[model samples]
Target: MRSETREASKNVLGSPLRACCHNPQTGYFRDGYCRASEGDMGRHIVCAEMTDDFLAFTKSQGNDLSTPNPDYNFPGLRAGDRWCLCARRWQEAWKHNRAPKVVLEACHESTLEIIPLSVLKQFAIQAMN
Candidate 1:
């Protein structure tokens, strides 16, 4: 028997969190949402739209998001793919001028602890009306 549970999480907008990506089945739990648990040290909660520069930057950092890993079920990422990334890594990318656009509605509120909302807003893919 198997069961699935979702955390009562909120997005950066203080609203109910939304799914980030489904094509790659993102999230720390691989459930398409950017929720994180206490044990999730990586804090994979920042929902970012991939870019060529960002992918190359991350790969240089040794994460290698573009390489397919069958053992882990990772089908490799390409530009335009939406992924739940580590908050700190995103900040690092920002510092290097390679940060990808972020989806505020899909980013977990906990990400605020690592990256400021103002910074995230600067790279938001959509403007809040």
Candidate 2:
């Protein structure tokens, strides 16, 4: 059986939502949606509010999230930007105290499988009410 995280059929807690602004490239499928499917192994499920510190830290770890790369269709990232990030990567950042804030409405519930809800709640920016 597939993991619950891998079986997320819709955006967490809401309808299909746009996780990122597409002026530049974003999203696992590059469709600007954070929805996951059977083919998505990295589990790009968290809609994180990008920050300079997290971006720089990710870059230092060799991900280079800030540099635009045409070959991979990556238009690059910037502070205050929104993007779908892998659950594992986000949790890893949290482990190191580099995890950025998150948009709860945009974040996939699959994230809860890897990270605690209370932890995510601590970084939440979007209001549920």
Per-model C-alpha RMSD: 3.9, 3.8
Candidate 1 lDDT score relative to the true structure: 0.88
lDDT of 1 at 128: 27
TM-score of decoy 1:
0.92
Which parts of model 1 are misplaced by more than 4 Å? 1-7, 127-129
Residue pair clashes in candidate 1: none
TM-score of the candidate numbered 2? 0.81
Model 2, residue 39: what's the lDDT?
72
lDDT of 1 by residue, 3-99 (tens): 2245578889998888899889998889998787776788898999999999999999999999999999999999999999999999999999999
Task: Give the Cα lDDT of each candidate.
Answer: 0.88, 0.73
Q: With candidate 2 superimposed using the best TM-score fit, by how many Å does residue 17's alpha carbon deviate from the native?
A: 4.7
Best by TM-score: 1
Candidate number with greatest lDDT: 1
